[model samples]
Target: MTLTAADVPLKRPTVLVADDEVALTDSIAVWLSDSYRVRTAYDGHEALREFGPSVDIVLLDRHMPGLSGEHVMARLNEMSANPQAALLTATSTDDFRSEVDELGFDAYLTKPISKTELLGVVSDLAAAASESAQH
Candidate 1:
């Protein structure tokens, strides 16, 4: 049977999650799956490969094996027009406060992040994106 546009599922906002920690990436993907179309990548290169213009938010690990999260963020910024970036790091915020601001991330999240915080950030990013579009 041919499906019409109304028969197709809605296209949710896409979120690219990049982290070296396999378990962490999986967990975050699960949490975000309900609200967003999550794309998971184990390393920076993989993340960069999967990133696209439709991605609404980027949850990136600060210290990956090859390209660091910071590096990936830089590349994403260059490729996409002002994508929302959230840095995931084990280090204290003080360690990267200056760097985060310089990199233009929308949020800074430390490791062991709670699902609530994760969802909140994604919600905020989505809201911001919606607002931007309306302007």
Candidate 2:
């Protein structure tokens, strides 16, 4: 018996979620774990430590002790990683849209994000990333 290409399982996309709030971080990880390979970091520094080329998406809290999400995004940029990144913060979109655009985030979502919204955005980002990788 020979295995065909379709017989092999596709690799799940990896999502790195970083937030200073332990419960929030854990919750998001749990929500995404069913569809993706999810990694959680409790701080910006830990986020950076966990990041690598294999990460397909990033969900970062805009404000954290030690290092902010902005700082982590900058570091990821410095590393030349192309993962789609989202700023998931309590900050209002009106106050942060320009900054989010300038910082090169692929998407932005305020805190209290519903599981449906989170999953939708991640699914879109994952699809985009996969499309880009193929070209």
Candidate 3:
């Protein structure tokens, strides 16, 4: 059976990985490249510039030089079709986690994220968003 474009699954999740750490961002972009059209931004300003309505999700580091994740998240939320986002941080404390969650993220993940976990979260979130959009 010859697989055409429609036959192939629609890789609809386009994720933005905003982090100053080049190595880590590259690693994630590489890992997710197969399933998602991943975009990398060095800082918040770049993230804002690169981000658009087409993006499905944003995986932003809590800390960065130009703009903090919190600030970026707020800015993103102001958009018409706000993209689903999650804070990936090494500083995942109970209080901090709760606070970030309260700000309303699809998920909050810790640093050193396993490939399996990242894939699962991205997949589930994308599926849910697709379903919601369809309705």
- Using TM-score as the measure, the top candidate is 2
TM-score of every candidate relative to the true structure: 0.88, 0.91, 0.89
For residues 1-28, write the lDDT of model 1, one tens digit per residue. 9999997656678899999999999999
Predicted structure with the largest lDDT when compared to the true one:
2
Q: What local distance difference test score does each model get?
A: 0.87, 0.89, 0.83
- Looking at candidate 3, the ten consecutive residues that score lowest on lDDT are 95-104
Model 1: how far residue 86 lies from native, Å: 0.4
Candidate 3's error at 6, in angstroms? 4.6
Which is better, 1 or 3, measured by TM-score?
3
TM-score of 2: 0.91
lDDT of 3 by residue, 1-135 (tens): 888898777655789999888999998899899888888998999999999877888888889888988778877777655677888888755767666775567887788888889888888778876776677
How many clashing pairs per prediction, in order?
Answer: 0, 0, 0
| Cα-lDDT of candidate 1 | 0.87
Clashing pairs in 3: none
Distance from true position, residue 130, model 2, in Å?
0.5
What residue runs in model 1 are displaced by over 4 Å at the alpha carbon? 1-11
The local lDDT score (0 to 100) that residue 62 gets in candidate 2 is 92
Q: Point out the worst 10-residue segment of candidate 2 by lDDT.
A: 95-104
